[model samples]
Target: MLFVDFTPPAPCVGDLNNDGVINTADLAQFLGQFGQTVAPGTGADLTGDGVVNTADLALFLGRFGQSC
Candidate 1:
């Protein structure tokens, strides 16, 4: 028997609000958690460092205005 790979598409890094787009609303969502230690695997923690910092901010900016 052969098994096929079943990898799921990764979530959009900058779509913090998970609204199918990366925009001001996601920006707002990110800002709301800025400087805080976000929960593990949370969108606000873009860098996945467990904290929402400038790194995540920069990443968010880079992907802003993108559609999921």
Candidate 2:
């Protein structure tokens, strides 16, 4: 038998609160978790690489003010 390690992607990038929109709340959440490693589905890790750093922040900035 064959097995695959599949991890689902975040529903939306920068939508930390998962309120179906990327707004200030998400921004706050991201900032709070900045420079840390968080699991997928959590808006903190925008890159989905398990780390919340400048790169993720940058990606999130690109999606800022946009709704999912």
Candidate 3:
């Protein structure tokens, strides 16, 4: 017998709410924290650059309509 894991990976970083989809809600969330660093609970830093800026915006735009 063979064992394997078939579970899909977690949603993209853009899915800020972990809602399994990257949509307006996530966008709103992203915008809400667009100028701050990685705070206690905010997660809008899509590029892991320690700050939310164009880099993270670009990455978020890339996955704006993604489903995961």
Give all TM-scores, in the order shown: 0.82, 0.73, 0.81
Model 1 accuracy (lDDT, Cα): 0.87
lDDT of 3 by residue, 1-68 (tens): 99898988854678999888889998999899888888543499877767888888898899888886
> Could you say which candidate leads in TM-score?
1
For candidate 1, give the lDDT of residue 52: 92
Task: Give the clashing residue pairs of candidate 2, or none.
Answer: none
lDDT per prediction? Answer: 0.87, 0.82, 0.83
Report the lDDT of model 1 for residue 8. Answer: 86
**Candidate 1, TM-score vs. the true structure?**
0.82
**Model 2 — TM-score against the truth?**
0.73
User: Candidate 1: deviation at residue 13, Å?
Assistant: 0.6
lDDT score of residue 59 within candidate 2: 89
Model 1 alpha-carbon drift over 4 Å, by segment: 1-7
Candidate numbers, best TM-score first, in rank order: 1, 3, 2
Query: Which ten contiguous residues of candidate 2 have the minimum total lDDT?
Result: 37-46
- Looking at model 2, residue 58 earns an lDDT score of 92
Ranking by lDDT: 1, 3, 2
